[model samples]
Target chain A: MKPNNPLKKEKIWRVAAVLFWLAAWQGGAMLLNDSLLLVPPARVLQRFFALVREKSFYSAVLFSLARNAGGFALGLAAGVLLAALAARARPVEYLLRPLMVAVKSIPVASFIILALVWLSGRRVSVFIVFLMVAPIVYGNLLAGIKSESVQLREMGEMYRVPWPDRVLYIELPQLKPHLMSALSLSLGLSWKSGVAAEIIGVPRGSMGYALYQAKLYLDTPSLYAWTLTVVLLSVLFERFVLWTVKRAYARLERL
Target chain B: MTRLIDICKAFDGKPVLEHVTLSLAPGVTCLMGVSGRGKTTLLRILTGLETPDSGTVEDRPGRIAVQFQEDRLVESLTVGRNLQLALGRAYDAGKAESCLASLGLPGCLQLTVSTLSGGMKRRVSLARALLYPAPLLVLDEPFQGLDADTRGAAIAAVRRGAEGRAALVVTHEAKDCELLGGRLITL
Candidate 1:
């Protein structure tokens, strides 16, 4: 096992680097004497605290969270199901090949704009997030499934174990790591694409709406604050979800 | 009875088993072959997972069990669960617990297959095959990872398990023939 030093004094070098960068930002803001291009870190922090107290700000956070999370969950389900099907049947994979390629190649902004004409603004983020995630989940999961050792499957067959038993015992253990890889990559992508969709669609009273309002009104501090809030939420949610997956893996390794 | 007649197996373009004929009844039989000489292929053919180019097998009992050259066990499941999967619902926990006890693997039912040493996994696979209520058992190098003492016990367990059933074992060890009372067939 490796040494455990969560935040040793050695990290002080990194801290110094961070502090130096922040000082540089403050100096640049002072020289610019303008809030439009960039606001000082202190003012941004102030606006962050101010927004933290507002109930509507919490609602905005919740709104984006709900849509993005919902989309991610749906994508995960569909991707696994589709990958399983595709793995077992060549016809299914052939049918899906074109669609998966298109989904992978297309840009997020294109999809967001195209979806706006068809879907309600409130649902655009969900659709965009789902689109962004499904192919990654599908491709990685299918690859994972394919990489499964055939020796294990043949042993299961010789034992005459039931289908469910084979899936639970032989297939699942090999599949878990691949599924985790898919989830880690797709979760971050969904957040980026989901929020971008929201900013463009500008559904009423969302985080995107707040950011846009701050920009239009020249409230640089509020805009910077909201950006920070989005960044924080994205990081926090990723950590929480990944931590759960890692715990599951640790438990499985002991099984 | 397990019968293979006119068995012909080929890979790519070359033939492995050509016009081969064999039969095995209710006894321990050892298959001896050179490395890469297609012992695994023949075993796979017996399991119906491989197709011989021109062969017909008869009396292949359903619910047959195999302990392949490789462990072929889920490396993330407990030893007990591995045996349970092979043995089906007929597995008695007490019986399984006792078997593991005798095999020096007691109190390890909760341990995952991945955490086990190579010898431990070999024993687990051996135990799984022995516990399964199959009319026929196929084992390929089942003693590969066992120490001398463990090998003796595993040989005894296999003999007891194959008392009224047909078994096919593949091993290069000469003592394996004497241990299991196996009739030798060299290819």
Candidate 2:
């Protein structure tokens, strides 16, 4: 018999739990006996496979992916720049306080609708994603900068470490965990709010439009399949981004 | 020569240093004081980390290497990178390796600082200060967590590295001053 490994055992338990949930979902669908109300997991998987075979599926996925990724990048850059400015100058922090608060407090749906008035339907999702992601990244990065070691800063100053070297060596290492957290949280919000904006705006060549169509025709399995696609895409993008960040840090550490 | 003329510093309405004057030149100086006697406050004033409320610092060099009371190293980075933060354009892989060896930490350039023991971290912090190319070196409690044997080695390394440059080391031990052949300044 193979040696009993704790990690392997944990994996087995996770698989079992997922299987149990699928079984419960299947049983509930059978009892309901209405595909329109609640589609079976198997049927959703089948529809998902069928959608994957369609050429339009790739276009929609690509369209949504591009907008979400672009918005996330813009938000990340703006947040970091704003946080740096805020950390440096008290006046900037004071100036940005109300703006960040407003962005955070506003509801995503309201922002999506407001964005629709200002932007084209295709561009609304991008704007909404940026709005959702910026404040989160800004807040976390500001906190990280605030919490950075005064002692380390003094050390840098005493050694006369250049600005670029100080950032690459001292600041970046200290900010990694905060940046990772900001990325993790904002990525999910970006995808969710992006898709919501898409559904509301009814943008063409987008996953949100496909979801809207599925809902219009009362095609429950198609809705479930599209939702699953969104979830998978969000998860995959997050993992990819986080993995790249970790690899970069690893290489930096090796130096 | 660098001079602090009649320096006075207070924190939260309590005086840490009061009208204290001192001068530093190209030699080792051990600053000894009892707890709460402002030995570190003096170092901070000299290194320009803290400004004295009523005094002037004359001829202070723009670059002074410092080993802080705490390790203050980037925990996720390797020993080499931590040193590189201080050494900057002056960093040399071979010199860094040899410096670590002299500080009794041989072949530890690739080891992450978080994995090191407290004493090892202290030595790395000291090594960074000693390796930095600066006119002055300020070490605050540089020998805090080491055993007697390691402490002796660290002191010897400091002695060797402080040649042709000014060093102000803070400690409570008179023997440390004797070992470094440094003039003792008691606060």
Candidate 3:
């Protein structure tokens, strides 16, 4: 007989809990007898399966995925560069303080509306995601760089250790935890605000457009299915990005 | 050999080291004093980490090695990597292995610094300074976490490393001076 595994047993219970919830939802929908108010889980799943088979579904997924990924990459690059600059120079920090604070404090919706006037609908999500994520990365990484030990830095300087080696051996490891935390928080915000922008802009071939169309026709099952798709994609993307980051950190340690 | 003439340093209007003049010449020089007496401040001024209010450091070496009060090892790096970082282009894996072995940390090259005991970390810090090729060595509380036997061994290792070179050490224990076979200057 196969050995009993606690982790496998735990996963079994999680699946059972999800099934119980689905059954409860189906029961509630039956009691109401109104598909418009609350669609049954079975119907939502069926619609989701159907939606996945369509070519437009793929198009919508790819369109929004591309914009969001583009924005995330751009924001990560710019944030890391700016944070490095600001950490080293007091004048740079003072110059960027007001702009970073403004970016952080401004509402996502206001930015979306303002961006709509200057950019095309397709680029709106990209701009909003960039705006949402850059400040988080900048603030967290700046704090990480500042948290480096002055004593260690002095030790490096006295030893005449090269600047690149100091950064690789001293600063990067110190920044790892802060960078991981910032990425975790910003990745979710990237998707949430990106989707929100897409919905407002009504980009022609995007997931947000599908969500809007489902609501316009009062197709509750399709709406639920589209929402589920967005959630799944977001989770997959997050897991992929985090796994990549973990691998990179492992490599750094090995080096 | 390095020399400091009338080095004076202060923090927030309170003097830490006042008009202190000393020289390190081809042997170990141990600085001993009570807490807050500026023994460390003097070492810092010699290492160029801090500027004296009114003093000049003479014969400053082109290259210097130092072990701070804290271990200052990158916690994520292995023992060998820490030494390599300090030594830079002069790093040699075989030399590092032998150095660690001499410090009672054999085969520790593969282990991350965080996994080491406090005494082990202190030894690693000392080993890094010893292995680096420099004319001058500044060691601050190098035996802080070691037992009597380990402290003796570290002192011997330091003496071996400091042969034909100048070393400045700061410690609370007067016994360290005798163990290191060096002169002690009480602040």
Candidate 4:
């Protein structure tokens, strides 16, 4: 009785496409009839539901969630502060240019391995997340700072709007889009690179450890399950962070 | 109470202002000059927004309100906040409300500057300068984008609000000077 939604129809078509590819995967698995090579989508979903019931699974998810989220939050703060400092000071900008370039250019895997040596196994994911995110956040915030219109600044100066007012009325509005973009981008990268670090390091009670165990035991379904959960969690975290940022912007607009 | 003695300015060693000495008094003085002349340069030098290479300016006060050539309102903020930023917290809402009322922007106080028209933004900027507590008022073509009646009203309001303070009105139109009932300073 409900009218068909055009956007929902498009989404349904996308889901159908995913199902088609999944059918191909199942057909390929059947042809091989090999448990080691692959597992059906149905089995993966079933195993995912079962895995959710396990307390260790929750702990592993919680551990990774905390580390990566903590790292992201820390990087966000550090990036904004540093970018502001750098924007104001030519010397700081010069010093950080090479460092930001290095972070941006260096392979995520290389950082994971190097960070494994520099940081504790428990802290590897957090370190990796920070390394990945700091450069991204810095780049975005710096661009925002640089792109601020000169005329507006002149206006503020002429008005003699107090320092706090200048920051709130001018700088904050200019920085919002960059801040929002940095948050969304850094979150996704942090989760991906953070888990990748955990997988290589195999830290105890971490999501990466569970993935490693699943791989070692040839439990393909559990591996897929963890992968799915990580993707879902990453998306949810990004949405939540962006929502918080939007709410903050709304409050600022009101002010 | 302001004086500029033999002001000369150059950019890239090419002279923009040549031995320009001008003294400013209270009320509007419509600045007139041909294109590429130094009318804006003279205003900028007087406001201390720019320094002249060979001038000794004296007797200036702490506060000067300016309506720049470009209406420099915060695009994200409301029309009211733009004026508030200039006027400071010492400003009362009632006065701001009435000032905006005079400018025909009373109903648009809640609307953001981004949504305002070009003429509206100019009016807001003009209103801001009028409301600011200042010893001097400098206007750079403040009537750039207003209708005839609004322009007349704007001129009246500025003259009424200036209250014998030093007001320097810059305009290409001689009639604009006549309207403000002030002396003319032509570059």
Cα error, candidate 2, residue B165 (Å):
2.0
Tens digits of lDDT, candidate 4, B1-187: 8988988999899899998877778866678888768778787788777889997779877788888888878888887777777778767778877887787777777888999899988998898889888888888998888999789878888888777798888888899889888889788
Fnat of the models, one by one? 0.81, 0.91, 0.81, 0.66
Task: Judge candidate 4 against the unseen true structure and give its global Cα lDDT, from 0 to 1.
Answer: 0.86
TM-score list, all predictions: 0.93, 0.96, 0.94, 0.93
Q: Candidate 3 on B92-168: residue-level lDDT in tens?
A: 99988888888888899999999999999999999999998999988999999898878877888999998889999
Highest lDDT against the true fold, candidate: 2
In the range A39-142, model 2's lDDT, one tens digit per residue, is: 99999999999999999999999999999999999888899999999999989999999999999998889988888888999999888888888888999999
Q: Give the TM-score ranking, best first.
A: 2, 3, 4, 1
**Cα error of candidate 4 at position B59, Å:** 3.0
Q: lDDT tens digits, residues A216-249, model 4? A: 9988888888998999899999998899889988
Which runs in model 1 stand beyond 4 Å of their true positions?
Answer: A1-20, A248-255
Inter-residue clash pairs, candidate 2: none
Ranked by lDDT, the better of candidates 2 and 3 is 2
Chain B TM-score for each model?
0.95, 0.98, 0.97, 0.95
Candidate 1 per-residue lDDT over residues B44-134, each given as its tens digit: 8887989889989888888787888888788778887887887788778888877776677888887888899999888888888888888
RMSD of 3: 2.3
Q: How accurate is candidate 3 locally (lDDT)?
A: 0.91
Show how many residue pairs clash in every candidate, following the order shown. Answer: 1, 0, 0, 0
